[model samples]
Target chain A: AQTVTQSQPEMSVQEAETVTLSCTYDTSESDYYLFWYKQPPSRQMILVIRQEAYKQQNATENRFSVNFQKAAKSFSLKISDSQLGDAAMYFCAYRRRTSYDKVIFGPGTSLSVIP
Target chain B: DAGVTQSPTHLIKTRGQQVTLRCSPKSGHDTVSWYQQALGQGPQFIFQYYEEEERQRGNFPDRFSGHQFPNYSSELNVNALLLGDSALYLCASSFWTGQGIYEQYFGPGTRLTVT
Candidate 1:
C-alpha cells in the first residue's frame, strides 16, 4: 500500500516571501503521480501542482513548483512570492499508474501567510 | 462550464441513522470519486464510480456505499452511522483516459455531523 506523509503540521511565511512544504511517500510502484492540493478556509480543494515520477525534471506552475526527488521518495512544494491568498491547508497525494486506482493523501500542512 | 458540486452543504444525523450525500460531476467529466475528510486531516478515498459502476474503492468498510448515474452524477450512502462517521464528504470529478485518470477537480464538500 502507498502512503503519503507531510511532516509539518503548521507553517508560516511572510507576504511576498517564499515557502516550502515537505512531503514524502512510500510506494512499491516504479511509476506513479504525485500531487499537491490546497484547501482554503472556504474548504475548497484546489490542485496546486503535479509531478510524474518518471520525469526527472521538477514541475512548476506559476508561483507553485515541486522538488520531486524520486530516489529519495521526496516531493516538496515551493511557493514563491507568497500572498495572503496562499494561506491554506496543503495536502500531498499519491496515485498509482493504473487507470482506476484511488488516491492516497497525507495529513496536511496548514500554511499561514503572515502579512 | 460548471465545476463539481455536492448537495446539503451541512447535515446532522443521530446515531444509528442513515445519511445520503449527492454529487454532480463537472462538465465533460465521466468519473466521480468520493472522499472523507475529518477535522484537521487530509481527505481519505472512499470509492470511485465510472461508467455507472464502482471502478475502485479504498479501505473503507461495506457500511459505506455509493451509486453513479448515467449522467456521471453520484451518491454516497452510509448506514447505521456512528459519531466517528462525522466528517466532510468530498466529491471529485475527472476525465478517464484509456491509460489513466488525469487531473481531478473537487467540490466544496458536505459537512456531516453525527450526534
Candidate 2:
C-alpha cells in the first residue's frame, strides 16, 4: 500500500514572498507520478504541478515547482512570489504509472497569503 | 474547453437514504475517477472507470458503486448512506493513451451531507 504525508497542517506567507509546503510518500513502485493540487473555497481542485518519478529534473510550472528527492521519497511544493489568489487548501497527491491506477492524497495544508 | 463538470452542487440526505452524483468528463477525456474528501482532509480515491467499466477501486465498501456511460459521463451512487459518508465528492477526467493516463482535470465537487 502507498501513503502520502503532508507534515504541515497550515502555512502562511506574505504576498510577494515565497513559501514551501512539504510532502513525503511511501511506495514500493519504482516509477510513478507526484502532484500538487490546490482547492479554493469554491471547491474546485486545480492542478498546480506534477513530477515524474523517473525524471531526475524537478518539475516547474510558473510560480509552482517541486523538489523531488526520489531516494528520500520527498516531494515538496515551493510557491514563489505568492499572491492572495494562492490562498487555499493545497493537497499532495500520488499516482502510479499504470493505466488506471487510483490516486492517493495526503491530508491537505491550508495556506494563507497575508496581504 | 470546459473542464470537468459535476451536477447538483450540494445535496442533503438522511441517514440510510441513497444518493447519486453525476459527472461529465472534460472534452476529449475518456476516463473518469471519483474521490471522497471529508472536511479538512484530502480526497480519498473511490474508484476509476474506463471503457464503461471499473478498472480500479480503493478501500471503499460495496455501498459505493459507480457507472460510466457510453458518452463518458459517470455517476457515483452511495447506498444506505451513513454520517461518515458526508463529504465533498470530486470527479476527475483524463485522457487514456493506451499505455497510461494523462494529467487529470478536476470538477467543482458535489457536497453531500448525510444527516
Candidate 3:
C-alpha cells in the first residue's frame, strides 16, 4: 500500500514571504503522481499543483511550485510571495498514473499567513 | 465550463442510517472520484468511477457503494453509517487522456455529520 506523510501539522509565513511545506511518500510503484491541495475555512477543496513522478523537472504554477526528489521520496510544495489568501490547510496527495486509481493523502499542514 | 460540483453542501444523519451524495464532474471530464476527509485530516480516497463503472476503490468496506451515469455524474452511497463516518465527502473530476498525468479538479465537498 502507498502512504503519504506531512511532517508539519502547522506553519506560518509573513505576507510577501515564501513558505515551504514538506511531504514524503512510500510507494512501490514507479509510475505515479503527487499533488498539493488547499482547503480554506469554507471547506472548499481546490487543487494547488501537481507533479509527475517520472518527470525529472519539477512542476510550477505561477507562485506555487514543487520540489520533487524522486530518489528521496520527497515532494514539497513551495509557495512564493505568500499572501493572506494563502492561509489554509494544505494536503499532500499521491496517486498511480494508471487508467483509474485512488489518491492517497497525507494528514495536512495548516498554514497561517500573517500580514 | 463549470468545475466539479457536489450537492447537499451539508448533511446530518444518525447512526445506522443510509446517505447518498451526488457529484457532477467538470466539463470534458469523464472520471469522477470520491474522498472522505475527517476533521483536521486530509482527504482519503474512497473510489473512482469511469464509463459508468467503478474502476478503483480504496480500503473502505462493502457498506460503501457508488454509481456513475452516462453523463459522467456519480453518486456515493454509504449504508449503516457509523459515528466514524462523519466527515467531509469530496468529489474530484479529471480528464482521462491516457497521458502521463492528468490534473484533477475538486468540488467544495459535502460535510456529513453523523450523530
Candidate 4:
C-alpha cells in the first residue's frame, strides 16, 4: 500500500509571491505517478500538475511546477507568482501508471494567498 | 466538452438506510473512479470501473458496491450505511490508459449526509 503525506496542514503566502507545498509518499512500486490537486471552497477538484517516477526531471505547468526528488520520495509543488485563486486546499495524490489503477490522496494543505 | 459530473449534488440519509450516487464521465473518457472525501481530509479511493466491470477496488467492505452502464455512466451503492459514511462522494474520469498516466478530471462531488 502506498501512503502520501503532506506535513503542512496550512500555508499562507502573499499575492505575487512564491510558495512551495511539501509532499512525501511511501510506495514500494518503482513505476508510479504523483499528482497535485486543488479544491476550492466550491468543492470543484482540479488537477494542477503530475510527475512520473521514472523521469528525473520535474514537471512544470505554467505557474505551477514540481520539484520531484525521487530518492527521498519527495514530490513538492511550487507555485510561482501565486494568485488569489491559488488560495485553496491543495492535495497530493499518487497513482499507478497501470490501466484503471487507483489513486491515493494526502490529507491536504490549506493555502491562503494574502493580499 | 463536459467534465466529470455526479448527480444529486447533496443527499441526506438516515443510518442503516441505503444510498445510491451516480456519475457521468467526461467527454472522451472511458474510465470512472469513485472516492470518499471527509470534512477536511483527502479523498479515499473506492473503486474504478471500465467497460462495465470493476477493474480495481480499495479496502472498502462489500457494503460498498458499484455498477457501470454500457454508456460509460456509473453508480455507487452503499448498503446499511453508517454515520461514518457521511462525506463528499467524488466521481472522477480519465481516458483509458493503454500505456500512459492520463490526468483525471473530477466533478464537484455529491455530499452525502448520514444522520
Candidate 5:
C-alpha cells in the first residue's frame, strides 16, 4: 500500500513570489510515479506536473516544478512566479510503475496567492 | 482535444438511493479513471478502465461498479448510496503507452450530494 502525505493544509504567497508545497509518501515499491494536481474554485482537478521515480532528473512545466527526493521518499512542488490563477487546492498523488492504473492521493494543500 | 468531460455537473441523491455518472475521455486517450473527492480532502481513486475492462480498483465497496463503452466513454454506478458517498466525482483520462507514465488529464468533476 502506498500512502501520500501533505503536511501543510494551507499556504499563502504574494504575487510573483515562489511557494513550495511539501509532500511525502510511504511506498514499498521502488519504482512509482509522483504527481501534483491543482483544483481551483471551480473544483476542476488539473495536472500541474509529474515526476517519474526511475528518472533522476526532476520534472518542470513552465512555472511549476517538482523536487523529487527518492531516498527521502519526498516529492515537493515548487510554484515560481505565483499568480492568482495558481491559487487552488493542490494534491500529491502516487502510482506504482508496474501498475500505473491504481493511484493514491494525499490530503490537499490549499494555496492562496495574495495580491 | 475536448479533454476529459463528465456529465451532470451537479447531482443530488438520497441515502439508500442509486446514482449513475458519465464520463467522456479526452481525444486520443484510451484510459479513464474515476475518483471521489470528499469535502476538504484530496480525490481518492475509485477505478480505472482500459481496453473496455476494469484494470484496477480502489478500496471502494462492491456497491460501486462501472462500464466502459467501445467509444471509450464510461459510466459509474453506485447502488444504495450513503452520505459518505457525497463528494465530487472526478474523471481523468490518459494515453496508455504501457509504461510508467500515468500523466492523466482530469475533468471538471460531478459534484454528487447525498442527503
Candidate 6:
C-alpha cells in the first residue's frame, strides 16, 4: 500500500515572500506521479504542479515548483512571491502511472499568507 | 471551456438514509474519479470510472458505489449513510491519454452532511 505524508499541519508566509511545504510518500512502484493541489475556502481543488518519478529534473509551474528527490521519496512544494490568494489548504497526492490508478492524498497543510 | 461540475452544492441527510451525487466531466474528458474529504483532512479516493465501468477503487465499503454514463457523466451513490460519511465529496475529470500522464480537473465539491 502507498501512503502520502505532509509533515506540516499549518504554515504562514508574508506576502511577497517564499515558503516551502514538505511531502514524503511510501511507494514500491518505480514509476509514479506526485502532485500538489490547493483548495480555497470555496472548496474547489486546483492543481498547482506535478512531477514524474522518472524525470530527474524537478517540475516548475510559474511560482509553484517541486523538489522531487526520488531516492529519499521526498517531494516538496515551494511557493515564491506568495500572495494573499495563496492562503488555502494544500494537499500532497500520489498516483501510479497506470491509467486507471486511484490517487492517494495526504492530510494537508493549511497555509496563511500574511499581508 | 467549463471545468468539472457537480450538482447540489450542499446536501443534508439523516443517518441510514441514502444519497446520490452527480458529476459532469469537463468537455472531452472521459474519465471520472470520486473522492471523500473530511473536515480538515485531505480527499480520499473512493473510486474511478472509465468506459462506463469502475476501473479502480480504494478501501471503501460496498455501500459506496458509482456509475458512469455513456456521455462520461458520473454519479456517486452512498447507501445507508453514517455520520462518518459526512464530508465534502469531490469529482475530478481527466482524459486518459495512452501514455497515462494527464492532469485531473476538479469540480467544486458537494458537501454531504449526515446527521
Computed on alpha carbons, the lDDT of every model, listed in order, comes to: 0.94, 0.95, 0.92, 0.93, 0.90, 0.95
Cα error of candidate 6 at position A51, Å: 0.4
lDDT of 6 by residue, A1-115 (tens): 9999999999999999999999999999998999999999999999999899999999999999999999999999999999999999999999998776888999999999999
Q: What is the TM-score of chain A alone in each candidate?
A: 0.98, 0.99, 0.98, 0.98, 0.97, 0.99
Task: Give the fraction of reference interface contacts each candidate recovers.
Answer: 0.87, 0.89, 0.84, 0.95, 0.82, 0.89
Stretches of candidate 1 exceeding 4 Å from the true structure: B97-101
Candidate 5 on A1-115: residue-level lDDT in tens?
A: 7899999999999999999999999999987888898889998788788888989999999999989999999999999999999999999999887644677899999999999
**Which candidate, 2 or 3, has the higher DockQ?**
2
Instruction: Give the lowest summed-lDDT range of ten residues in model 2 chain A.
Output: A94-103
- Superposed by TM-score, candidate 2 places the C-alpha of residue A52 at a distance from the truth, in angstroms, of 0.6
Q: Give me the displacement of residue A16 in model 6, in angstroms.
A: 0.8
The two-chain DockQ for each candidate, comma-separated, is 0.86, 0.87, 0.78, 0.89, 0.75, 0.87
Q: Which ranges of candidate 2 are over 4 A from the true structure? A: B97-101
- Tens digits of per-residue lDDT, candidate 4, B4-101, equal 88999999999999999999998888889999999999999999999999999998999999999988999999999999999999999988565566
Candidate 6: tens digits of C-alpha lDDT, residues B10-104: 99999999999999999999999999999999999999999999998988999999999999999999999999999999999998776668879
Model 2 lDDT tens row, B5-84: 99989999999999999999999998999999999999999999999999989899999999999999999999999999
Please state the interface RMSD for every predicted structure, separated by commas.
0.9, 0.8, 1.2, 0.8, 1.4, 0.9
On residues B36-93, what C-alpha lDDT tens digit does candidate 1 reach at each position?
Answer: 9999999999999999999888889899999999998999999999999999999999
Candidate 6 deviant stretches above 4 angstroms: none
Residues A1-115, model 1: lDDT tens digits: 8899999999999999999999999999998999999999998999999888888999999999999989899999999999999999999999997775788999999999999
Sort by DockQ, top down from the best:
4, 2, 6, 1, 3, 5
Cα lDDT tens digits for candidate 4, A73-95: 99999999999999999999998
Q: Name the top DockQ candidate.
A: 4
Provide the clashing-pair count of each candidate structure: 0, 0, 0, 0, 0, 0
User: DockQ score of candidate 5?
Assistant: 0.75
